[model samples]
Target: MRKWLFWLILPLMVGCQLGAPDQNAPLPILGEFEVVNGDTIYHTIRDFSFINQDSQEVNNQTFAGKAYVVDFFFISCPTICPKVKKQMLRLYERFKDEDKLVLLSHTIDTEHDTIPRLKKFATDLGVGLPQWQFVTGVKDSIYGIANDYFSIAQEDPNAPGGFDHSGRLILVDPQRRVRAFCDGTDPKSVDQFMEDVERLLGEMK
Candidate 1:
């Protein structure tokens, strides 16, 4: 969908509360964007390979049959990222043990967020193991992949921390299609998104 159309539909589709009738609402499948039989087609998260905080290679195959949440950030970000991380912490604490769920926090500043830095960042967050991962890798590839997920991460001299990026937490289903997203800077929205997460997990089962 076009960017303007996306924002128009997003609000209407999100905010599903667990106890409400809309709790069972289906998540939207993002980006119908491919060419097949002389026509356009929908798209999904394409293949990618990057290094996680653990220094292990992570790719689409790594998340096969699993649903995951993703966000872009840099450790030294002076604005927005910390707030986003705070909410991400809430998610990590709650769903860390869910067998089918995982969180991929990718850094926009890949040049500076090395394995050691990400490892320390993960430590500082008090989340780890099979649940959460702070990833950093080739800058261009990371930026391009972020766009593929319908998120943004690019350098900006005028922006704080020298980077401009979206503060949205994206949800992807087992099939690698974007299911939902929320403003990571808002705690209330994250709370509602938490409910959506639970509902999605239950739906997948």
Candidate 2:
């Protein structure tokens, strides 16, 4: 299996063996860890700034005090993107009223997925800023951050839409730590992911 898929599946597999999680217990923080002095440090999302569909700057500050879901895709992907997006739309509807949660999508096809195109994409989905943000930025920056979410985003001339990316939905806590993730193309996976989302929201309270 690929490295990104390993990371994505590891957490979910561990989660399953634990059976029903305690409602009061915090979700386990996923990702690499290291010891600094005597304290253990977990991986965190590197700071990023991108232009959203509304032309507003979106960065870590945009999600302050909120949990966010993240994914990578292009507007024209012909394979799994549409399936992933359908699940994402489920998340949008599920958490649209929650002030403490947000959704962020990064477009890998920066050359074509311009701000106007992103705006149209969101508009067609009946979603908009502050709740769900579709963003574009430097290609390298977008691809680099995909690693942080344990997702993959890259270009391939032979790939559909000239891009290849993982269809993973990542749940990040207020501190920018990855809390949970699921295969975005699977409705059942996303259903469990929603439960994890609610669990994380409870932690924030």
Candidate 3:
């Protein structure tokens, strides 16, 4: 297991042993931190700009004042991507009515996953912009941000579908801090992730 995955699960294990988690308690901001001048600084999502399915630019500001679920996948991914998308759709259905939440998916196969392809994919999935944004951008930029989300996205000839990536659905708070994440290929994990999403949303309120 990856180091970040261990950290994510450790809290859940402790919570189980200690009984239910405190509803009012804020979710832990995951990732590296540093102290400067006695003040702590948490890692945040780096600034990025990508064209969404609607041909509109999506950047950090697009999610301003809103919490969002993020994932990395290509429309053509043959292995875990479909499973991840199914779980992501569950999240979309559950929180589509919430005005403070959004979903962002980035395609690792930027060369083949062009704007028109992304638009068709979104349309076929019965989802649209503002609430759900399917974005594509420079290969380096897309793969680079995957690290910030604790996800894997890269090209490899031996990898299934010619790319290697992790099916992680990451949750980001309004402040751009990673609050929670789950194995997108596992339904049970996603169920727990939904609750985490609600917890974070409540915290934002």
Per-candidate count of clashing residue pairs (backbone under 3 Å): 1, 0, 0
RMSD of each: 3.0, 2.9, 3.2
lDDT (Cα, tens digit) per residue for candidate 1, span 1-205:
5667765765565544212546657755665555679986666788889899899999988888889999999999999999999999999989988989999999999878889999999988888867987788789989998977778899999999999999999889888888777889999888877877887798898
Tens digits of lDDT, candidate 3, 1-205: 3456756775574345234557778787877777889988888899999999989999999999999999999988989999999999999999899999999999999999999999999999998878899999999999999988878899999998999998988999988888888889989888878888999998888
Per-residue CA lDDT of model 2 for 1-205, tens digit only, reads 3446666788666457246767677788887787789998888999999999999999999999999999999998899999999999999999999999999999999999999999999999999878999999999999999988877899989988888899989999999998888888888778888999999998888
Candidate 3 — which residues are off by over 4 angstroms?
A: 1-20
Q: For each candidate, what TM-score against the reference?
A: 0.88, 0.92, 0.91
Model 3, residue 152: distance off in Å is 0.6
- The lDDT of each candidate is 0.84, 0.89, 0.88
Candidate 1 lDDT trough over 10 residues, lowest sum: 12-21
Q: Which ten residues in a row have the lowest lDDT in candidate 2?
A: 11-20
Clashing pairs in 1: 32-42
**lDDT winner between candidates 1 and 3:** 3
Which ranges in model 2 have alpha carbons more than 4 Å from their true place? 1-19
Tell me, by TM-score, which candidate is best. 2
